[model samples]
Target: MSSLRETVPWQEEPDDGTDGPVVPSRDGAAEDIRLFDGAMDPAREEGLLAGLELLGADAARGAQLDFELLRGWQQHVLHTPQPSAFRNLPAFAKKGRERYGIAPDTRARLDACLAESSTAGGRSLPLAARAARACLDVCFFHPFEDGNARSAFLTLLFVLAREGVALNDVGLLRRITFQATDPQDALILARYFDAHLAETRRGAACPGS
Candidate 1:
């Protein structure tokens, strides 16, 4: 089976010259917590909140992305006393429209891709692109045994928060279903990030309604 990770158009997404606001005024992740809570069972809601708390702390400390870091969060996302482990077999998604094939080096590849989410060494990917790619990476990599969608969402949030950016709203981001093989999906995700970032900046400039 063809891997979704191999087809993502990471290099094709354009960087709009700016990376939105350097600081965000509101907690968009908190908003997501509420939104997720309304849609999920109580245990899942608690897990989401706990995962978000871990994301906030990791972002504050400038922690880089990695399997270990993700596992730390996935424990909360899965509502498990222990961190979730990487999947030992292939994973399917989109009602079987996509298949993420497994390999001996799959976890290593995932780790390498996660590391790219960092802006270190003067990496030029815009904040929006980095976050979008990180989300896609998690979605397609299908790293954990369960809760990969929630994990992807948290990864995106961490990418933005690490750089002092957060959205006041993320409905466009969280509600969409992206295809791994479509290059347009990658660009569209980046555009969504751009939209949210712009709106967050505007809200920050205004302070109060």
Candidate 2:
């Protein structure tokens, strides 16, 4: 089978034009949901919460996307002393059905793709598309040895947070696995982001009703 890292439909994903140029919305929806997630799994959610905190801090300072930045988040995610480093050898997922082979320049390629996650790279793509793409990047890249799913989730949240778009409900995102090679999956994820954005905006409009 071909490497998922290469087969993933990263470039073909389209932006959901429903919401244009997102403005900052300081809704602590992520925190609330993460708290709920914590109740189910403390150790796992603690790292998620920690990573979220780091994401907020990094967003506040207008930090750029880089491997080290991800490592910082991954360190907390896996409860490791140092930042988690990129895997040097091939990685597999989906019970050995999907393989992510590493090449000599794989790290560099991953870095370049991540850099596009920044707001400056794809100006035309709306917040949802960019955020979804970044999430998928982590998924397909399989950067770390473990906890890549969590890392991908955090990346999605960070992208939305930086753009001031936090979802009131991430139920659609949770427990849903995406395919790397399917363009439809990309569109579906972007639509999920749109749905959450719509709900969050509606809630903001009527806070106590």
Candidate 3:
């Protein structure tokens, strides 16, 4: 498995609805998708790279992962049951789109933000704050036909990991997810992630004998 830096390309431009720099054909795509199906196999190592790559691309504004694309990747890798991929953006615009529907405009807004965040420029804040804002924006936008929350969470992890931030506390993230009621709640969660990142960084400092 390649390092996240090595496997994923960092793009400064927005994805223009193309297949991305690393397009997956039927055969190649299947192999890439299979890498992250939640199965306990050596492939997971490779799958993690693939998953990071996808999220990174999304973050970089390299491409959009519609519901179908997300489900296809999930099925190929994890073989999990998911909603139909035929859903379009208008279907996602209704109230509670998080449950069913996605607004096309909102999807574009979120994608643009993801792309901006992926690149290395922005206001300096606690790492967790940035992650929280990014993740919350996606969750609030609920852009995809499905898996908006999952995508937001995964994208947050991928961005932080790329920044060399340690995030070994899945429990904390899960707890925050359950607690978040709105965008503000997500921001609060980001504070926690920032604190965790700071502590981890301190712990990694070399010990002086």
Best by lDDT: 1
The RMSD of every model to the true structure, in order and in angstroms, is 2.1, 3.2, 12.4
Query: Candidate 1 or 3, higher TM-score?
Result: 1
Q: List the residue pairs that clash in candidate 2.
A: none
Give all TM-scores, in the order shown.
0.91, 0.85, 0.51
What's the CA error at residue 195 for candidate 1, in Å? 0.4
Q: After superposition, how far is residue 118 of candidate 3 from its true place, in Å?
A: 3.9
Q: Predicted candidate 3: what Cα RMSD to the true structure?
A: 12.4
Q: lDDT: which is higher, 2 or 3?
A: 2
Q: Model 2: per-residue lDDT, tens digit, 7-83? A: 44545654545453343244444565466667778887788888888988997787877677888999998899988
lDDT of 3 by residue, 47-155 (tens): 4445555555544553443333344443323324653343355433334433433454554555555554444465444455556656655565554555455556565
TM-score of 2: 0.85
Number of clashing pairs per prediction, in order? 0, 0, 12
The reply for model 2, stretches above 4 Å from the true place, is 1-36
Reference-based lDDT, residue 85, model 2? 84
lDDT of 1 at 122: 92
- Displacement of the residue 99 alpha carbon in candidate 3, Å: 6.3
Backbone clashes in model 1, listed as residue pairs: none
| Residue 93 Cα positional deviation in candidate 2, in Å, after optimal superposition | 1.0
